[model samples]
Target chain A: MADHTATSGTNRKVCVEHLFKVFGADPADTIRRIREGAPKDRIYAETASVAAVADVSFSVAPGEIFVVMGLSGSGKSTLIRCLNRLIEPTEGRILIDGEDIVGLSADALRRLRLNKLSMVFQHFALFPHKSVGENVEYGLKVRGMAARERREKALRALEQVGLAAHADVPPANLSGGMQQRVGLARGLAVDPEIMLMDEPFSALDPLIRRDMQDELLKLQQQLRMTIIFITHDLHEALRLGDRIAIMKDGRFVQLGTPEEIVAHPADDYVAAFTRDVDRSRVFRAQSLCRDAHALSADEDAGVAAERCEALGREALFVVDAERRPLGIVRHRDLERDATATPGDALITDFPSTRGDAELVTLYGACATGLPIALLDDAGRLEGVVEPLEVFHWLGGTGAEGGGAASSGGEGEATPASAAPSETRRRDHG
Target chain B: MADRISDFYTLPLDDWIEVVVKEWLVPNFRPVFRAVQWPIDQVLGGLEEFLLWLPYPVFVVVVPLIAWRVAGGGVALFTLLSLLFIDLLGIWRETMVTLAMILTAVTFCVLVGVPLGILAARSDRFAGLIRPVLDIMQTIPPFVYLVPIVMLFGVGIVPGVIATIIFALPPVIRLTNLGIRQVQAELVEAGLAFGSTRRQLLFEIQIPLALRTIMAGLNQTLMLSLSMVVIAALIGAGGLGLTVFTGLGRLDIGRATLGGIGIVLLAIMLDRITQALGEGRHAQRPGLKESLTRWLKGLVQGSKAYNERR
Candidate 1:
């Protein structure tokens, strides 16, 4: 892991190495013992210190949303604040864009904060007495921008968050979601290269939380700013993260992309979190797709029907040499039109989705009474997404490795439109 | 039990104070004392001359207008009637003199108090040190300190102002410290994260948020100043305090009653005005009728933007 992170160090917008933040007496001594391989509990027992972030190390790539996820008191928040020296690390090197910020003088640190990084607090720490416009302009004012320029920039930032009209209103008048928007705008106004967001949406209601997540994703796409988002919500981490680091007891248990995590959780702690994830939201079409079981468009209909029957498939996808889907040909159609080629019996009404399309987007397409076609970005047939597989995965009963066959019962019955209970019955049987 | 507590060898606090004053403070602190006294005299003299010099009607009109604008019409009407009552009692001159003395003491108190408060709020060590000093300043009886002031600086309006300042300075300092300390930690963190200097954070974030509380402190200080300024009359500081004192001395009930009434009116006016300033500009927005009238006036005058903004 260290080798992997060190190789990517050149591209890192922020890199933290051996970061330890122990909150109590003689934190340095505790950090030294931790480095010497003492267990955190043992160290705490010996020193009466709580190891908040214990010997953590990671590097965030520029423009990546690196989410640090954990339960409360898991030290995820402590780790992110350590990135900007907001919570000074007990012992470590925090390099931002090749410069070590750990020992930067107060003057240099202020310059780093002003130009290189900004933070959006979890509670939307807007100045209560300041107007929304003023709140957004705060960083610029600290940088000593002229009054008129700062105002224009502040107005533009507010407009970016769809709050231009609320510029003059007090922050107290805005809802929690709107207040977080102001927080986002305030960070954006500085146009910092990286933003440390400490669970910016954790304070909002569920619906608003999702809305802010979408807004953040949209903004990230446009700005491509490096963001270190802290959250305890696994679903939120999966939804917004490019790569997520799961923290437990102030140590990162696993670090991988959302798909990697869902497909293969690192441990039972991670597995428990993934169990309740809405698989439709987390898994993409690619994860659900099985091999297309396609026949050449020129193949004889009888041959295609025989292939489908042998494979226990109800239908076959007929594709050209380039693997562009021609259409689906049901086994019955192939059997009825034995003289015709598979292309002649092809039914073009089947739904096709891209490989990267989320299962939520594939739900309607998959419900068309025919097997859903999963295609690559070039429109080449990838595979078919079976409804039974989707239900099993979403219901958290499916194994991580797919293609586990159901035993006994429903031997010849088509399983595509089977209710979830029927699919479970087949599986248990 | 008392003898056991004292150990029959008690040190004399007053003798120590006397020795320290004569031996240490008199020779080393005389110039500092004179320097401080100069400003108090200048401000008191300037304000006294101005207040007494103003045409009575002009002063009365201006005060009522300020009251109307700041605290609204009810307080404005009260101010007008109260001033007129003082005038009828023929102590308006004396009332203005008392106002001057209170104003001078408050100015000095604010100048000294706010900085000490900010210092206390910033540093834990300073706060710890200043806490007991503030307690002593507050708890010591005014007459007890007046004796020391008379012995050191002699009796005059300046000494009286000094005495009043010592008594009234604690609240402004305490409240300012409290206000800044009570500012939300997250806001302070936000300021720091954005690269604000210690000075910038104090002025831009902490002070503005603490304004209302600081103003409450000022209000307390002003009221304290009024009461102490009255007591300072025993040291020969002339104002309404002298009238009340003279009235009491010769058993002149009517005179003392008039003087007491003037101080009450002056206290109410100052309290209402300063309280309004502390509450911020829009906090005392006029009633619906006045707002409607202002809106209509703006509409008739065709100041479209102004009316809409309100």
Candidate 2:
């Protein structure tokens, strides 16, 4: 296995330039229409079929676990499958290291599968008949390893997933998490340079889902396989993806780092979609921190009171030892009538964000007023930030265009015209 | 027929001969197989000559080796014991003749039936055309195959071998098709992705994976051949089956018992060994039990809900 190279400057993992995948109803004609820039509606009317994925284009960087996220009917799953030619595209090019994959013959496709790619299906498609080991060994066997070697590889893959003992047994004997691990091992048995996962943990219970996520995190740390994961869950996307591509209809609305996407959503659709996220969980203190507040080396309650009145902010940053943010001092804490401190009151009444305390973590764990202080890696205070800044970064209150981002109010004709957004409409229906 | 009935194992001499002729002799000569008769006949003649020239112990070692590889140790041991029994029965040469006949029939099944099954699986037209014919081949008693076989092929090991193939070919075809069809879709995709040609996919992945199920069909075919060939004895298909049938013709119960005992031993040995081989590591691994248990539990609970819904 190659060492986990970051490939920081150049990415050659997977590239699709001018990729076109057309399915159903005279795909050739549809492609001709779509190519001539006939408006999407006119093309659809003529074809009586969708451009499930239109002339889309993107490239995933090497060693980066990029997520392609979309709600149902967005063709995200189809797009991923098209990468492996499980669902072949009708036109244009898909290149890996600048080689066109679209032109590959069946034998060539098989060779590609054997050598580089392994897929984790949404259903965790473990071969029901094989033991966990055999399931793991399947790709190895296909790639023509001897029995003993395949067995050893299978065991090693299983061990990586913390399922070494279960390798000798059937996957059916495992829990859902364990079964998913077996699927992961099966894909890993080939020692694939790239892994494609389609909503691999979507069906698991939440706790198991978290465990699977942790497992992926651990595996990615060790293996650093270039991964293109598809999912509809924003939480999942944020938690695992190094870079996220938000998709809608048949196009990508935005692609950026989780922080970038959260900080500046392309539109209201992304904003509303990311609304429920615990901001503190998604936001970093570094992004929100300002310079530490000034303070007297030694100030009594009387002097502190005068300083508080002078600054009419919602909260105050308390500094200590160094000129770094310490605990917080709320204006209200100075009033005895309120939760604020009264006459001769100090600012220590409220729970303060220690310099080292992560605002997002503290915000998630506790309900504290913002302008939360930033802290150094050690316990010393750095600066302070408003919780509202997190909301601002998420673009919950500010975003650009109206696409997948304007998830609210823009109830247009969805796939199922008659049904509201409660469910995806049966296009045929 | 009632008066002739002695036990589950025994039938009247005529009844027995009728079954062999009907089941083993006539059925093996399917139109497709017979269509290639010129080449098949030449090959068969050559093989017969070759085996005839070979010494008994050599045949003994060679035949047992085939049974051994197909199943392995237990079956191999049973094979040795069965050969010894036939030798002790004073029908060593005849039993060897029957063994040759069986080997020939099985080889025919593998050649014709496997391809037919694969074709049927790949194409609806083939399956549609063959289904009714296979159903008839299976339901008809072994005795029903005789008169036509006798008229067409003439009496001997060649004709008897023909009959045996007919009776045995259907299962191999059906199971081969079934096993191929039942292979998991993802694995098929995996094979395609990994560079298996359609032919390679079929032979390397599909066929190997399907072996356990196909072996079941093979076991059935073998057992059917062993039973049917005894009646092929009347047509001069010299084997243990014929010895038993001839013994019964003269009301020689002791001779019949020995012949019957030899068939039983051979059948048991074949069944145990093939069954063992068919017990794929996939099947023997502990996971299926858990899955089976889980499914059964789910099934029982589902039934309870079904009852409630009713």
Candidate 3:
């Protein structure tokens, strides 16, 4: 499990090891019982304590968007708060930039918060009495920065979020989305190295939420700051996360990139979440394409037909010297003119798509009955996409069935398709 | 059965309190009570002297101007009319004395109450400890504590002011604590997230947000102190209370009725002004300096236009 994390030790931005947060009178005793393999419910019944975060560990690479995705009461909120020591861990070590913060003195932890860490809250946590600019500059003011410099930094941060004009207005005067921008500006004003966002857009309207998400991505691209985003919305997790950790009952059930998780869920709990995912949008043509066998464009028609028959393919791709696809040569066309060269029998009006095109965009091209050629940036053929591959993926059983099946068999449906469709029917019905 | 119930033993709580106050508290705590009276005496004496020395005409102008700046034209007119009527009632000196007493008591209440409130707000244990003390201070009748106050501090205006302070101190403290505690939890967390110290959180976040509530508390304290004046006059505190006290004793119904009217007028003016302050409408209204400059500018411009026309 540790190997799944992209970075290790000193190179990582934030590393949490064996974190535990038990809400009760005797956390240490409860932890001991937990380590002894007592059931969570029994322990709770006996001790009346909630183990909010239980022995969770992960490392985040620098400039990575590591998302913790979970439902309410799944402890994602507790886990994010533990990162900044907002809620102190009952027992664990949290290393920020190779220094363990769990045992730091109060002053030291405060300095760490001022210098390195900032958080954006879900409810926009803006001070109602302060103007937006004042709210943005609060962190800088706490650090005792000079007035002029703090104002400049605050305005610059507000400008980054497109809210410089509203800085003088009170937070109550702004809409929810604009208030959250002020919250973001407050986190950004200090130029912290790691930003912890706890469902920062959960209170916003869906349209505004998407805009904020896009804005965050844009800002992150320019700043390259490591971000740990917590959200209960799976779509939000898939959209913003570079890597995601799916949490259930105070523990991480699976952690992987969005594609990896959608392609291969770890358990039924994870598969249940992935089942509702829009695979056409989450997946790209590159993920579904297969290696294509090509014949030289200069080859004879009789020789191309013989090669196509040997390969048991209806048509073969013809490419030039640079591997750029020229056209498709069908076995029937080649056989019709056996004495002619394959170039004379080539069909240049073949369907193709970009390598990075989403599967939804390629569905029309796939229906042309000809295998759609996936082309790279240089117009060279990367691979070919069959119609069955697109349907299998959209059919909801492609991940479990493994990569695209090459043979055209009618009975290729596996029993793995049943549960996901059952879930889908129940959800829609 | 009725005879048995009637013969049941009693606790002798009243006799026990009388013994404690007479033997232990009053004799042993005279110096402590005197020390407490010293500051109130200085403030009350200075305020009374100052108000008496100021010409009545100065107050009739300056106070209405203040009212106009904080509230609006209607309140200012009401203040002007009320002050003129009080002046006409032939109890101006007594009204000034009562104003001095109310100011002294409220000043002490605010100074002592706000800090205690902040302390209570910060710690649950402190809040729990102070809650019942505040309840007893508020619920006990003013007359009940008057005897002990007289025994310890003696019969004077200063002791009367001290009694008023004790009677009126609870609301400010309770409300201050309540206001600070009522500051939203997320705002406190945000302050902490930004690395604010405990003191910064109190001053910058908690106090500013709680200002309106605290001001409401101040208003309550002022009204309560004004109510205590009549009771304080029973122990020889001179004020409109003394006017009513003497009038009632000598059966001069007209004098007592006039004094009562004077107290009501003062209460209405103070209530209106303080209530405006608490609502914070004054923040948007022009301040005294700004209004003066703007009025001066308008007058100069009007005269210049007249000269040009000539």
> What are the per-residue Cα lDDT tens digits for candidate 3 across A147-205?
89999999999999999999888899999999999999999999989999999999999
Model 1, A311-400: lDDT tens per residue? 788888888899989899988887776788887877988888765666778668757767888776588987887766766666655644
Q: Where is the poorest 10-residue window by lDDT in model 3 chain A?
A: A420-429
- Clashing residue pairs for model 1: none
In angstroms, give how far residue A384 of model 3 lies from its true place: 4.0
Candidate 2 structure quality by residue, lDDT tens digits, A1-429 = 111233211446687766667777688887777778776667667767788787778777667778999999888988988888988988877777656778888777878877888888777767665678877887787667899988998899989888899876767788888888888887887888889898889979999998888788777777878899999999999877777889876777788766567756789888777778765455454544454344543554444556667654555655656654434544555543343233333344344354323335555423565565544446466555556554554454532322133224233311111211111111101
Off by more than 4 A, model 3:
A1-8, A37-40, A292-357, A369-382, A404-429, B1-31, B281-310
The C-alpha TM-scores of every prediction are 0.86, 0.63, 0.87
Question: lDDT of candidate 2 vs native?
Answer: 0.70
User: Could you give the CAPRI-style class of model 1?
Assistant: medium
Q: What is the lDDT of residue A359 in candidate 1?
A: 71
Model 1 has an lDDT value of 0.85
TM-scores of chain A across the candidates, in order, are 0.85, 0.71, 0.86
